[model samples]
Target: MDWKDAIIAVFAILLLLSIATTYLVYHQQQQTIEVQEAIIEEFISARHIHIETTDSAEPPAFVDRYGRVSSSIVNIIAIRSDTGLGEIGRVLIEITEGDGDVLVNTEPFIKPLVQYSVREAVEVAANFTGTNVSKSDITVSFEINGTVIGGPSAGAAIAVAIIAAMEGEQVRHDVAITGTIEEGGYIGQVAGVFEKAVAAEKGEITIFLVPCGQKQAIYYERQTEEIEIFGFTFTLAYYTPREVDLGEYMAGKMDVIEVATIGEAV
Candidate 1:
């Protein structure tokens, strides 16, 4: 072959070799990336899903509004020096589908640790109903009209709300409840049953439920008298020695049902 032709042939061979080398490099890189992706997916699949406690301070668990339930709190009776006997306060509870933790947020209310423990007890009850509470986060909120909700009186009402939210049931608006919830799902006696019952009736609640055996309630009557001292009037308050049994007193006003457990209350 001629020298010029020979040189041209060598150049063509080199060009072909370069093209093949480039193709192989590109193909090998693509394969490496594919293998890396598969390994990553396998690792992800093998990793177990674990639940970590939420952010700083263990903020309350939260649920979405996709499903919701609510319950009415019985009114509590409070005695004021100026006023003798009257229905004073009530509490309202709302629940929704949670995303495994439970957060009970109270607005202008009370119950402290009693309410928290009550929520935990309710969780147990809800789980017994086949609800995957761990897979859900529940939020319980209490609404009151500038009234403080002290003690564990909201146990029964809160339980019903949690169950209704998980099961998507309806809670009667005219029904009110008060009682302390124990860890075993049994309810305990609460204070101020008469006041709570009276408040429920005042709110037009038709069904009022209290803890069983809490048939007697003590309404502490107080007498206040104003006395003039150095141009300023002073008032003194004292409790009266009168205690009344609530079983009969409540019988005539509303449908009072005595429940021993959350299952019975529901």
Candidate 2:
């Protein structure tokens, strides 16, 4: 081969090696990202709760409709750390896809339509509750943008907030409650009940409400004080009181009312 031709061949080989090295580095980075995503997915799946989308027939289902509004109450569920924070982390929200009419409707653009609806629901619920703002002014407005929400666990607190807004009463900024609001207005129980209760106590909450099943968490929290133990199981337990027991607690200190509907919030 000629001298110039040999030099050209050497340059070509070096260029190919550089390209190969770049490709390998890029591939490794992609794999790292995928592994991190899988880890997050696993964690979220284990901690997440599945909430079914509301029936399509429920008009004014999104919070913005202007009709004389009725309310649903529910208990909040899921897990929390003992660090006295109320932020929900790494939540996985999925929409119901069983009905083709709902999600897979044949219209050319309806897939985006259904997807938008689901996104709206997730945004309203997750964004609103994730913050420290009062639930009273946290109005969840919806549009034709196609949104739905589930996990009815936040219904009770939402109902209480809504009732306060409707009646022109003030909700204490220092207090928080958890429970599912059923269509009939009964508050249901939730998991991680103790963690949330303990958080409320640590925050010096003036009042906290929970379903009957979780009353024990409160009873124990009221009696606890800071201890210098290295590591121990934090037990938040309480005895279930009789139906009238809550009424007595309500008279003084902090009120824990068990009402079947938003109408009974006072």
Candidate 3:
């Protein structure tokens, strides 16, 4: 074959090989995407838990006497297995006249601390509203949307909801709270304040209430430094926790208020 013909044959072969390789790569990518989607679907189906919803037609047992009240609460998902970042979920409280029992409905069970928080919330609410908690029953429900929640951080919000129910008052939908309920109706500090605040802001909460001294969030700032030892330079990295006022940080976004007690929050 002539030199020109040989060159032309080689180019044609190379072009055909390139096209085959591209098609194979494209097919493999499509297969990978399909497998990923299937895995996600399976994961969701397996981990899915049923959340009970109140029917409008059928009135809740609490509506007759002590009115049902609900407040939004922010909780942190420390491990972002489902979502890439931290997410917040809602807590719904329903109170009625019963045997002072605190009931919770959630998937995969609930933490003992969460149950204790509900009891504390009941006490705090009773003190605030001057009602006999022994004559009432509280049912706390959680809505899980790609987030697993279990903590005492929602104690303040539960107390607020119970108090509102006892007083026949409604809580502001635009407000959310995160803190632990303590004796004397005081709110205690909890972790993940900053992460919870960001989630609350994204949820369109206008007013976010936190514990007394939690108005500022402590975050670790990464610092890198180079040190020379024995004519050799080494790089070191460290994190320093710095406090940032949550209120000031979220100024135009939302209002972050610090409440020492449930009464102040109410």
Candidate 4:
């Protein structure tokens, strides 16, 4: 029709196109936001899922329980590899949900034993608490504060910590134990009971638990005898077992109690 009419018609079409493009872009952005929100929700839900044991198809009652737990700093007595003397060391045990991993921040030589101890600790803890955790993913992490040779002597302490963690209880900071963990929640005897007791006392642990019948520490005393044979002098050196009564020795310093099982120690 007329030139002005034609210009107005073109302007109207351009405005409509611009509005349509803006609507499309806004709609796509809204969809993307929805997708991101869904993903975030799913991830959070997955994290909260309770780990289950293989013994039963139903989840345990403690599901989503104990997201993270840390035990009181344990006063562990270890012998120095170079000095061959008992040293007081500190270790903190942390338990969390993981793919059945044992993390040790100590010498590599003790990794395998620590792993075994963790597994046993878990088993013992589950049985003690009447729960099943064999198939549940768990991570046991150890943080050591001093340089000392590692061994299974800390098994009892580890088991005790695990039980406390699972039950949402706190282990007394003034108490410590030294022994190997055995089946049926028993505490197996370990060496260096006297040395460990001394270390525990130094670390301000008022109550120290040792394996059964270990309240008396047995040490060896060096004995030397010299004799002359065929105009030649010979010297013989031997060691004799000597016992020290821990109760009398540490009478006022700390109380050294003998424990037969992890339950008793706990």
TM-score of each: 0.59, 0.35, 0.64, 0.66
lDDT for 105 in candidate 4 is 52
Q: Candidate 4 on 27-115: residue-level lDDT in tens?
A: 99989867865675455334332224455555443445554443444556666667556676555555554444445554424434545
Evaluated against the true structure, the overall lDDT of model 1 is: 0.60
Output the number of the lDDT-best candidate. 3
Give candidate 1's error at residue 131 in angstroms. Answer: 1.7
Q: Which one wins by TM-score: 1 or 2? A: 1
Residue pairs with backbone atoms closer than 3 Å in model 1 (clashes): 63-98, 75-196, 77-195, 98-137, 99-137, 100-136, 100-137
> The CA-based lDDT of model 3 is what?
0.71
lDDT of 4: 0.69
lDDT of 3 by residue, 237-261 (tens): 9999899999999999999999998
Each prediction's Cα RMSD? Answer: 30.2, 18.7, 13.7, 28.1
Residue-level error in angstroms, candidate 1, position 55: 25
Give the runs in model 4 whose Cα sits over 4 Å from its true position: 1-72, 100-102, 106-111, 132-137, 143-148, 223-237
> For model 3, what is the error of residue 183's alpha carbon versus the real structure, in angstroms, after optimal superposition?
0.9
Q: Judged by lDDT relative to the true structure, which candidate is superior, 1 or 4?
A: 4
Assess each prediction's global lDDT (C-alpha) against the native.
Answer: 0.60, 0.42, 0.71, 0.69
lDDT of 1 by residue, 1-266 (tens): 98767767886899899999999999999898678656754653454323333344332233334443433343333322233333445434444444545566656654344455445555555654654454455555555555555545666666666666555455777777778677657878877777777777777877787798765666677799998744557688988755656656766667878889888887
TM-score of 3: 0.64
**Model 1 error, position 71 (Å):** 9.5
Question: What lDDT does candidate 2 reach at residue 189?
Answer: 73
Worst 10 contiguous positions by lDDT, candidate 1: 76-85
